[model samples]
Target: MAELANCPRCHALFVKGPAIVCNDCVKREEEDFQLVYSFVRKKENRTAAILDIVRETGVEEYKIREFVKSKRLHPAQFPALSYGCERCGAEIREGRLCESCTVSIRSGVQKQGELDDLEARNKKEGLGPVTYYTVNDDNR
Candidate 1:
């Protein structure tokens, strides 16, 4: 017999079964995995975008995406399997990008945050859109 210590996470004595982790840690991890799996499996939740999961589960977007990518064994088998972008929340079909995101990517690279970005930044900073005066002295 070897030494038996209570798991720090679950506070349960270690066992040599399906898990090297203590039962409590395993249960906690299993619960987290289930939450992630459910979020990925459901259609509405699937399209819920990236930050949604971050907000809901407090897991980082990149880590969540990695989990989705690595956990999926068969690619074609899971046609609907996808993750969302923190920017748009649209389903990333593969390589973590949807069609619109692909286009936006090309366009954003061209502008490099010259347009529309100002508005996003303003919003981020808690400032509403600024009304501009046109050449004709009219509000734009």
Candidate 2:
């Protein structure tokens, strides 16, 4: 069901559906995407840096970064283009977080793994098996 809500981008009344922003904002974003795409499609412009593209084509850097993040822009073709890490805001070619953040997350996982291993080892060594004794009805 669509709910009546104000558009986040333009603050206009719009039906809230699958899209985050209103139709007008979506149209504007499409136009921006087309403009950015046209600029980067040229062989000469393919190697241009994100900042340079922004300066030359008048497209916002964040839009280009969004394209990169969404896999709309291929990094192999555009060598000078990179997106900011979602965590540290450092530049990276692929993925949301940068290498440092990735390493930090990995270290955390390693610590968790160590704790899990220790718990399992303790459970195996500390717990004793329960002894069951069965009495025959004839004996009773």
TM-score of each: 0.36, 0.79
* Model 1 clashing-pair count: 1
Q: In model 2, where do residues sit more than 4 Å from their true spots?
A: 119-140
**RMSD of each candidate?**
13.7, 12.1
**Which residues of candidate 1, in runs, are more than 4 Å off?**
1-13, 16-18, 47-50, 58-66, 69-140
- Pick by TM-score: which candidate is best? 2
Model 1, 1-140: lDDT tens per residue? Answer: 55677676557777555456687766666676677667656666655555676688765566566566665422354444456665688766556566787788999787976667887899999999898885965765
Q: Worst ten-residue run, lDDT, model 1? A: 72-81
Candidate 2 per-residue lDDT, tens place, 32-132, comes to 88898898889989999888999987878988999888888888878888899988899999988998999999999999999788778878898544458
- Give the winner by lDDT: 2
lDDT, residue 76, candidate 2? 80
lDDT to native, each model: 0.65, 0.88
